[model samples]
Target: MDIPSGDTARKRISESTIHRLSRYFRTLSLLEKENFETVSSKELAKREKLTPAQVRKDLSFFGSFGTRGLGYPVAELKAKVSRILGIDRIWRVALVGVGNIGSAMVSYKEFIKQGFHIVKLFDNDQRKIGSNHKGIIVSDIKNLRTELQDDRIEMVIVAVPATVAQYIVDDIVKAEVKAILNFAPINLKVPSGVHVRNENMVMELEYLSFAMVNHHSPKGGGKA
Candidate 1:
């Protein structure tokens, strides 16, 4: 089931709507395991603590997933959502830096289960280089560009220090790898067409702290 690459639908999809689809996918997976054949919008909404209308609207943007009375087929909907999210097939990934956060990401079981396979590791420290973590050997940062290009990496997760992050990113860009998940605290400068997702733990924690003090809950099913 390949999703269309239509410009109109792609432009209309908000980050919020895509996020809810992920939630809906997870809910559908649980329903399948529970022996559910079909699920109504109202039922899915209740489980995810969202309004039925929002659920319907989100799913409608992609296409009809439910029948008039029978509702959406659980297993089928899950498969569709996975394809839409581009997690239906394996993505070869590389991780730069063997620090605490980087190591944790490699050990995360969900990454592999969800089709993100981190097959390369890079670090500047000579001691860390050549070391193996969970069967993937760490390569020297000097060989970062060549190794990434040779391995045909599709995405790179950066967990390096703030000072040298840009230098590392420059090499990645030169290699023509466009997707980056950066854990460095500083913002990275990348040219247009490059996708960079920053993972700032402190900023997220601050948001949670503010929410707690203000007695505020995230609206539009945006809670983490």
Candidate 2:
């Protein structure tokens, strides 16, 4: 992957671009597991349901990884994308709210495999404060700032209710966390330097339902 020189003026890449890169990485990893060595842009695009031009354009931003005709080595491309996404190194993550969603995240193996470790769990509830799951002792939310600073946790996942999500995020920011992945179904305002990504499962499911309904509409396959 091409690393831009200090003298090169770089423009901010879009989130969609990064999402596509992640897809490419995942697809490449699968292919690598199947013992594939190299793949062409056309083949990669076909696997991703993208145009060859689109795949090429997305990769071009990071520098050329593919040969003129032979294509990209699967292992090399996967590592490059992982590096670009900042997942090549282990990142200590703090989880706020050990409820259903938060607990699920705690047991999620993908995050750990992808180099994100949930080192701390927090909640304001007294009942949950001392609870333990997979060796993670739930701590009081009041200790978040000190624990984050002490542990040097740079990222946090906010799986709290919408009402208190922003408050938790504020505490995360005060602890100098750099990134957040929020599962609460609400918008949050954060400092300029902090990045927050909201994941709304309900919104996604609603959109999927709309698409399914449209697919079965009268003009398509549904009964009049």
Candidate 3:
């Protein structure tokens, strides 16, 4: 594959762009399921509430995907997007906590079905460490490094307590993991080049409540 120029590479693709690409792929999959053959960028953008120019630019980053007159083929575009995002390959994931949220995630069938396989689960609690969840045994946190290396886990899910978030991240960095999805409600300081995605449930719920309260307020005129 021809690499993009430095200028193109330096043109940082925002998180929103990546997310939209995934969304586009999902939409295309649905269209394919409905027997739709091709889709114009303008049509896709309208359905997704995005600008056609934005759609074109995002897809252009990969390569010329559409002809001047015709639009992108649904199946081809879906395959290209999946390949670009590295979703075509299975990604090994390791979970660092076996608490309620972590256990639920471990038992969630969606992750495994979506190409992210949880090869190892870890926890500090002795009783829980040796137990099994969804056919995967919870291992001791002390063995994180060894298990990570053995399982070739590239991505990690940090569900440890907030107090130990930083400590766990540090250990994860030392384990040479590339990407992390953090559920702990703490700002973690990771070394450069490592990706950390924080999923803060409390913050999301608070934001939702704020939106609801403001929407119903007299000052806001109950817009709905």
Which candidate ranks first by TM-score, i.e. highest? Answer: 1
Candidate 3 lDDT over residue span 1-224, tens digit each = 44468665545677778888988977888889988889999989987877899899999877899978889998998899989888888999999999989988988887886689988999999999779888888999988877887888999999989999888888888889989999998889998999999999898678679878877453423211
Tell me the tens digit of each residue's lDDT in model 1 across 1-224.
Answer: 34457664244688889888888888888999999999998899899888889988898877898898788899999999998888889999999999999999999998998889999999988999989899999999999999999999999999998999999999999999999999999989999989999999899889889988988867754464
- What are the lDDT figures for the candidates, one per model? 0.90, 0.88, 0.86
Clashing pairs in 3: none
Most accurate candidate by lDDT: 1
TM-score of every prediction relative to native: 0.92, 0.91, 0.88
For residues 48-122, what per-residue lDDT tens digits would candidate 2 score against the true structure? 777899889999987898888699998999998898888889999989999999999999999998889999999
Q: How high is the lDDT of residue 161 in model 3?
A: 91
Overlapping backbone residue pairs in candidate 3 total 0
